[model samples]
Target: MPVWTLYGIRRGIATTSWPEKEGPTQPGVLGLPHYHADRCQDNCRACADVCLPGALSFESCEAEERLALDYGKCIGCQLCTEACPNDALTKSNDWAFGVRNRDDLIWTEALQSPPAEEVTRKIQKYFGRSLHVRHVDAGSCNGCESELQALNNPYYNLHRLGIFFTPSPRFADLLLVTGPVTYAMQGPLRETYNAMPEPRWVMAMGACAVSGGASGGGYSCGHGVEEFLPVDIYVPGCPPNPAAMIHALLLLLNRASQHVQGGQVAH
Candidate 1:
């Protein structure tokens, strides 16, 4: 037998059984910063100041400045954790932040789920176990693309889950969008969405796709695809890892349960 073949044999199956079981891909990598609003000090905007994407912001209330943390705009840069002198914003491993609703990504917000049976029936009827995705680059920095490419690798092997990425939108059940929708790509993005059949879903695949990331509200960048397209899923990261993406996609198909609500991860 060839040496590589022998090595493979010794390794057994290289693919991990994740989403189905406890197959962790990235071990200790930091995810979005976890915010403890009660721990936050008065007049402290340190975390907000260091935030590049404005994930951490101040909301003025009745003679009070409440720190608002929006996971949709978080890029997982860890700068806020570093800048926080009050330990209000801290690093965490809570990367699997896929949600069915957009408001669930906001801090201190409440989230409610639809009837599971209704959702399950609808998903099983259209997608079942097999999901065909079409990725559209409105205007990405390609960080998300790099992580997305890892899905088909030997470790992750997204195909085993019956999820696939199709080049043509006509055959896709989900339109996975990345980046802040640029002015030039807006027309093409709309055209692609129009091609997909009814009952189609859209997944905001990154911080840019969810809420425009670092470049949002800036020159040459729109807020996100959600401004125009109806997003069914929101996966926020500078570039969500393959594991996180897998969770989000499955969450969309109702094959998995959403863990994050009101910007808090369920244990």
Candidate 2:
């Protein structure tokens, strides 16, 4: 038997005892949403109309002379917030949106602030003090890129966590790949990976990048990321909420155990 295969099998058995010993698993994704009433104008009902999943609704209160947002049905698209004439509604950087029950999806206000200090500490501990990332657009619809760009905003301030995105693959220590792997992108992806230096890591961000997602089995799809490159971490969800991306990046730095155990051993 080949040495690498034998070593892989042995390592698998030894690591199989992981979750049992590690603390309860952290969620792989998060989707926190926020509302800003101050920016809201009573005249705009665009949010109610634009919500594809019927997540947002309004109730007329004659006594209060205002409309109320139905927190339960909101899909966090932020379309309504963006469409509002008065700019009354706005979204926060918060992305830890989880609830015990399905009914908790609605937000009366922004959920609790993320543990910024704790996240910072974790990022520092995981990536070994300094980190540089190279981004690859495998085959995306550009939504993931939009959210990624937002990471540099004052609200998220990704740099504070010692994270930086490098324009050149040669300078990167981590590869932040987004989108499903498409036939056209296959060559570029491989070339980029080869360009990176040794001791590097790969983060497959978004559902498409992680598993082919909607593009999986599509005519143009190249199957999945694993077919092209070794993924050190998988961040699932369509254009994974930004916070989820942040958590996955942090996990890569910290060597957090993956959710799908032994599914894909890193090369």
Candidate 3:
């Protein structure tokens, strides 16, 4: 046997039991910036001005101006955290910011989705315990794909959960898509979705896949998968880490509860 195989045997299991229990994310891995409204300095738009993807914006309220944060558009560059003078927007490890409703990723609004009982029951009824996913690259910079590749690694060991990546859309129960939808890819994307049988679900896999990221509504691409495909889950990260992706998948299956609401992070 190879030296690597012997090393693995000595090291025992590398797969993590996460979601069921707490686990450590990569050290110093920057996630979304947290905004503390009380600490925000008045008349300052530092974070908003520095945000390239429009994740941070100034929302005008009656006689007051407040910053609006949309996690769906955030690439987790932590630029907002660096721009803040009052330390209002601080860096965090809040990487599991996935949700079924897009509004949950926005800071300024409260939008409730379909009741969990109704939707989750339907999904569980059709998909059962095993899920086969087909991933599509609509229009990407390849960053999301890089993160996705980690799912099958020894550390994550995705197959243990019974979720799999399939090559054929006809066998896929879920369409997990990354990147913004380019004009050239529009027809092919629809073709893939149509190929999948009914009870199929779609998941937007990144900031680019959720809101087209920095290239949203551009001449070459549309605003992520939501513009065309019916997205069942919206996972927002420039390239959400492996753990975040796992959480998103489990969330879709109703095996996990969402801790994010209106762009707020619980841990």
Best by TM-score: 3
For residues 1-267, could you state the per-residue lDDT of candidate 1 as single tens digits?
Answer: 569978878988888877667745688988988887778898778888888888888888888878888899998999888888888788888888888878788888444533223244677877877999999988999888888888988888999989999999999988999999998889999999999997788999899999998977676789998997998889998888778899998888777888887778877
**Candidates ranked by lDDT, best first?**
3, 1, 2
For candidate 1, which ten residues in a row score worst on lDDT?
Answer: 111-120
Provide the global lDDT of candidate 2 against the true structure. Answer: 0.59
What candidate 3 gets wrong by more than 4 Å, as runs, is 1-11, 109-118
- Please write out the lDDT profile of model 2 over residues 71-120, one tens digit for every residue: 32333566766776665566544343222122233343433323212223
RMSD of each: 2.5, 16.7, 2.2
Report the lDDT of model 1 for residue 123.
79
Which wins on lDDT, candidate 1 or candidate 2? 1
lDDT of each: 0.85, 0.59, 0.86
Measured with C-alpha atoms, the lDDT of residue 186 in candidate 3 is 93
Candidate numbers, best TM-score first, in rank order:
3, 1, 2
Indicate whether candidate 2 or candidate 3 has the larger TM-score: 3
Clash pairs, candidate 3, are none
